[model samples]
Target: MRIRAATLKLGETFIGIQLAKIVESKNPKYPVGQYVTAHFGWRSHTISDGSPINGQIPALVPNFGGLPLSLALGVLGRPELVRRDRNRCWWSVGSHVGQIAKIKGCKVIGITGSDEKGRVLVEELGFDHFINYKIADVDKALTELAPEGVDCFFDN
Candidate 1:
């Protein structure tokens, strides 16, 4: 299989996919017309019995309510699950997680590689503040931005 062929190969990484059923399934939970997300690596096809393996479980794609289902693999998935508290500070915010943290009413500070990216994080993405790691000392910037320390670090 392509998965076996790619195993232990340098520069090869597991690719995530949105699976569409081509045949009928015995499990009612995964019907023939349903779409699911699986971490079947770079292979084009895979078989699963709906049991969790390698920390990946075939899950029913969440309803995005007119938003693209692709968001399931991005913002709407693991990034939304990162813990956030309203009274605490959130740091290392990526574009998606920064929006989520802001919605949850946390003091969000984002770190990006460029000043332009930092501006996007704060001005457009609803982050409270941002630091450009390329030019600034991360430790010093973090200290100044969040003196009480970060409560959640959403490392995307």
Candidate 2:
């Protein structure tokens, strides 16, 4: 979310997180030339004192052990625990939360306004089902898809 600070006033630099390598450092925890993800958006260069920005310290990027260093920016931030049998509305978070739910083994059901987005939800993102509320009867569709009743309903 540090990318593209929407609330900035005129002439203010946007604030966001980015992948950066330490060209120089006085701190031994983060040696010179170490790769780190920092929270200073859109700047080509920056200096960090290893302080916590929004409660996150500048972490020394670990040896990936075959993983790409670019993933250090956020792939590690996903939920470590895998849950199952959950559902949500895709429009609530642009299929992001629904995808995460699917990754956790949930029987996800996404709701959108168009068939294209719905297809992406069910086909590409691996959601169990989708409802395009624009044309279909939501109540009837819900009854057909979840006859046992929906355990969760994410309305946005």
Q: How does each model score on lDDT?
A: 0.63, 0.66
RMSD of each: 10.0, 9.4
lDDT of model 1, residue 32:
80
Q: Residue pairs in steric clash, candidate 1? A: none
Candidate 2 segments exceeding 4 Å error: 1-6, 75-156
Model 1, 16-84: lDDT tens digits are 554444366888888886677776654556677888756788888766688644355543233343332
Q: How does candidate 1 score on lDDT?
A: 0.63
TM-scores across all candidates? Answer: 0.43, 0.43
Best by lDDT: 2
User: Considering summed lDDT, which 10 consecutive residues are worst modelled in model 1?
Assistant: 84-93
Per-residue lDDT over 1-156 for candidate 2, one digit per residue giving the tens place of the 0 to 100 score: 433445677787666566788898888888887788867565778777888876778777788787645346542223223222223355535476667656756566676778887897888888898888787787778788888865444332
The residue pairs found clashing in candidate 2 are 2-16
The segments of candidate 1 whose C-alpha lies over 4 angstroms from its true place after superposition are 1-93
